[model samples]
Target: MNHSSLDSTMMLTSFGSFRPLNYFFFSLTLLVYLLSIFSNVFLMLIIYFESSLHKPMYIFLFNLALNGLIGSSTVWPAIMENLLSDTQKMSFLACLVQIYWGYFYLSSAYTTLSVMAYDRYVSICKPLQYHSIMTPGKVKTLLTAANIVPLFSIAILVYLTSRLVLCKYTIQNLFCDLVTILNLSCVKSLLVNLCGACMLASLVVFPCTIVLLSYALILTVSLKASKGAQKKALSTCSPHLITFINFGVAILFFAVYNRYSSFLPAEVYILITIDVFMIPPLLNPIIYGIQTQEIRKCFVKTVRKNEIFFRICELTVFRKSTSEHNS
Candidate 1:
């Protein structure tokens, strides 16, 4: 391809594989995107309004839901747009924007989960000091760090990526990805790869280590505690654990697919791509909403309140109609 031809746009070649089932894929993707938005937004709203849930753990959960929403919104719009359209092209600037947000979401997500792990560690292992250790000010600081660090790091990566001279314009995956973008570069830079490695180390690997160590300590404490305490600890950590494992799987697929996509069949490649975007945002809310007792109770309460309001409206309507008839 001519360099001038790709000066403004990048093609997503994988989209061509699904053209035969474009309508079906579009409808399915739209449904998942809507559900992800609704679930994440609903969770955030519940945490926001329920003053009783104004605590450290729930606040982190709120951030997680917020991240999920961000992640879904970052890619799902482009995905749905391309799904319906014949051309699967994105401008270079828009691709960079997607790459920035997509990676930011991943970074902030792991960072938030690591913070949540530390919160749990304090709550379970150092119960008495939990309040002091995770003060409201500290919570704000952590949330700020979780979001800001990722934003800065991803900005650097995207900046480096933007500076590279690109000889290719086709991205193999569904959305703009840093790894795919790096692969598009005509010349290889060791500095970019080094920075990427370090970023992954600090943002992804280091946070993952924190999560593991925190849980290991939690497990040690749980093992020595009473059975009731063990059950409580399990209940508290299970949702985060499940979400982490699910996310880990998605990232693994992402790495393998990007690195070894040539060995994989087209169907498998498409499935992996869709799975990366779809599973986590869809599952995170469900996992936390169902597994976290406080959120579950709040949801029930909110539903009951709505039901009561609807019943009151029905009764008022009936009374108004009866009075009008009698008159």
Candidate 2:
């Protein structure tokens, strides 16, 4: 491979034969992408204007929304082009960039999720010390660590994977995922697969375990507290816990199922991916804002104001048309 094709691993293997429903799946992917973008942006706005949302939980949430936006941008743009075009070709550098960015975005989000777990852990495990431990300055440090750790990890993974060059490029997934891309290597891949597996276990699997354990302890502690305090704790944690489930289950799909089996079809791959990338961003705002009375009222008022402005604009354009008549 030349310097230009630095790490080309596009091996063309039919995962079997294509089906007509591939188009159907791709169309659904298109819809999911559009909705993901719209919903994430709305969530971002709700956080932006709401002074009451300045807590660390909401800060982590804003980070997730931003990361989800970046992740969708990396996957969805190529996907849309591939679906519409006859030639579905991505350049070597371009593919590498996608792999890099996808890793970066996901790592940042995963780190944030882990930090969130510890935040809850402290709140429940050490209630009075929670304020001292989960301070804003500390939260910033956690966010920074979450973002930086992933960058270093991705740099190493990319460097390692680049050692193998493909005879030609063939990938089964809709976009350039690391798993599908790694399997594209023509060279022997046992060691690479092992290393990647370790990385997934460390990054994805371990963090999820932390979250699960944290929440378990949190629930246990809350149960020991007074009934009112227990109810309030449950209310606060429930939305985060549910969003975490949506995200965690999706990560599990990528970490476990996608690694073990190549037996599933492309549509199944797409759906699994959408579970992680598309659904959480769409669901988070609805989960949090709908349950929070103040946010729900603000959203309704915003909608009414927009509707009124739109009707006034239409009336202005359609007004008696005195100028047109004179002309």
lDDT of each candidate versus the true structure: 0.88, 0.73
Instruction: List candidate 1 segments past 4 Å from native.
Output: 1-7, 17-20
Q: What local lDDT does model 2 show for residue 111?
A: 73
Best TM-score among the predictions, by candidate number? 1
Q: Which candidate is the best by lDDT?
A: 1
Error of 2 at 28 (Å): 4.3
Q: What TM-score goes with each of the models?
A: 0.95, 0.82
Relative to the true structure, candidate 1 has a C-alpha RMSD (angstroms) of: 2.3
Task: Please provide, for model 1 over 1-327, each residue's C-alpha lDDT reduced to its tens digit, 9 standing for 90 to 100.
Answer: 333433678988777854668888788889989999999899999999999999999999999988988888898888888888877989888888998888888889999999999999999999989888999999999999999999999899888777878878888777888777778888897888998999999999999999999999999999999999999999999999999988888877877877787788767766765666677888999999999999999999999999999999999999999999999
lDDT string for model 2 (1-327, tens) is 246357443432322345566588678778878788887888788778878877777788778788878888887777666665555666666777888888777767667777787886787678799888888899998888777777787877777766666665776666666776566667767777787777677777777778888888887888789988887777777777887777777777876656665666666776776776677666776787766555677678778988999999888877758668877
